[model samples]
Target: MPAVSSPQPSATSQPHHRFIKISRYIYVFREFSKFSIWTPHVSFLQSLRRLAPIPSPSFFQTLDIVAENPDKFRIVGLAAGSNVTLLAEQVKTFKPQLVAVRDESLVNELKEALADMERKPEIIPGEQGVIEVARHPDAVSIVTGIVGCAGLKPTVAAIEEGKDIALANKETLIAGGPFVLPLAHKHKVKILPADSEHSAIFQCIQGLSEGALRRIILTASGGAFRDWPVDKLKEVKVADALKHPNWNMGKKITVDSATLFNKGLEVIEAHYLFGAEYDDIEIVIHPQSIIHSMVETQDSSVLAQLGWPDMRLPILYTMSWPERIYCSELTWPRLDLCKLGSLTFKAPDNVKYPSMSLAYAAGRAGGTMTGVLSAANEKAVELFINEKISYLDIFKVVELTCEKHQEELVATPSLEEIIHYDLWARDYASGLERTSGLSAVPA
Candidate 1:
């Protein structure tokens, strides 16, 4: 069984300044439009013309929540990639003191975009710039939304600075848990889950007695191919995998959902977040994602967190933790069980999702194997999306990559070693497309 420990205490004192630092890799406007209620009103955007520095619309809900109580919360730093035009527009609205683009090349473009502003923010570029934003002194909490192992270093940096982590990036724990958890413990930093499932578990276990938790039930909205026969998987197209039934997410995550890799990764995350063993955490196919997650106590009593399948509630909770911020019922609609009629659950099919066993095995192996699994899956998904490989090859790529890493696996790896293996796994997984003889899907 994997290691399990109770939640650690957060830092003793909260910071006097209420500043937020956001770090994200990409921003998609289409995903933002899905949360209709959280959308910033046109008048609100117009009102911010006099001020500056907002995030991309993808993070508009986060910004909107912060903007609600301007005197209580402030946007102090931002880190983003590729979407410089959108990033620049946000910077002009929110007025963060510092901004960091993905690389040096994007710095000039971001600067040029902000040249017309009356108040110019200090801009930095590349990985180091993201680190600076993570450890910004004014920020009490840093939101880690950057995808993949790229988010690891900055998240570690934030913990070192004693900043509470609003954890949206799965890799921060899925890949770096062994390294990051100890570091977080050392600094007394609070790691708040910014996703629905983990947030659901975190909420239910809030006041539970130590040693009371017996099991963790993570709900899954059985992805695009949930109802499709197992034999039909080989015919899965790139577009097919991208069409997630419930959540509007990034390309990588949407595909992850279809493969059920997202839930597998979350199983490992639940182990780290709530200190439950691999055997204690289970996934159930819940077609309707109303019940985010549940925890079975020692008395066999189950506690659950329920809400409509919207990301706003979870994200808002991460921002306004220990205190629930009131939302207008008109905008933030209440969950009406009568309208929903019913919620259902069934066991996940192991044959349909080999990723589950791979995740559990890697998680049990501990250290570098989990990171390898994640990196390989990421690369495999990218290959699949590009039609370079068939859908089934995603599992083959990840499993073979993990197998190749077994000999070199380090149970107690340093930050450098974690990063090294992440890169190695991606490279190895990429090479599998050629050597593994997996047929590529016709473009």
Candidate 2:
């Protein structure tokens, strides 16, 4: 094609091209040989990851992937769920062996106990991996001094053995932060979050320079009572408090939601999880619950994670962070649906819900304020369910509990002292009966 006449083909030039082809083939053979040596070792581990767990159609169930590779890891489930059935299907697709199917039968237990609210009994709905309690070589014991059940000892043992934890139980950290965080550091295992708010903050802050993050703003739905008049709150029943208008959740969380106490717990979590100080975090009530949480940079710009009021999205997010998976079964949000209404936000009313302030107080005080707040709320909610106090009185008991423990907070006591304070708060709050619907047992 060149205008010049082509030179006669030469055997000497031909040998150069022939040599190049041979070189490429040799390189390919070397790679194939190395792969042969490694593939069996990798596949053997993959089989172990698939060990007793049946897939839940509702969750993304992407654990087997993390199982296959050392780098792929994520949280399973916590909070309540919206698309549990779909997540189960996704898990089957990924074909993970271990799944967290937290007693589907307890759905009736939750619904029966939470008859006043629209709490549907179902799986927490995210990771469908079976957490073999003691099967792994490195089993960690997870415990928190408060809450309905004990979780820390098992979590500690598991972490001690070398298994990284998928942490959902906040009270464990509340009571055992000094022990747990240090031990996790010593062992160098993972402590993944199961709380939506903390998970959101964790995702947003990833890879950001320290100086870039000005602060974190944790959002709350403000519960069903956000619109209820403060004057009339005393007459509110446990049934009324259980009704969260947007998200379907459990009785424990629903009660915490009503008081915005769960949000308070998240504030404490963000402090410990991210190492931010007392003033660095703030809370704003976003009623729709679409905007799960946000973080602000020093430049004044804010980053937020948005989705439907579905816990599975965040659960899957924790499991599938850094790389988003394609789930054909999951629904995508329409711009038309999202843009139809203004997303509203307001500062949490300090007068109506003082729990947020106490949370900040507990977090600032460190030691065991988080443990105390969790235990007190549990005790107060129990009293509400027993008809000893009206719904509004839940906050009253919690407030007095905090006030009574003011000295403990100020002193910044030891972890042992904090656990003692947590137990004392629970027992003291439970002792008094509902004197008036307007208020409750003072610590």
Local accuracy by lDDT, each model: 0.74, 0.53
> Judged by lDDT, which candidate is best?
1
TM-score of each model, paired residue for residue:
0.86, 0.67
Q: Write the per-residue lDDT of candidate 2 for residues 60-154, one digit (tens) a residue.
A: 22233333333332222222223334434434333333333334544444334434433322233121212232222222222111133244444
Against the true structure, candidate 2 reaches a TM-score of 0.67
lDDT of 2: 0.53
Candidate 1 achieves a global lDDT of 0.74
Q: Per-residue error at 272 for model 2, in Å?
A: 0.4
Q: How much is 203 displaced in model 1, in angstroms? A: 0.8
Q: Which parts of model 1 are misplaced by more than 4 Å?
A: 1-58
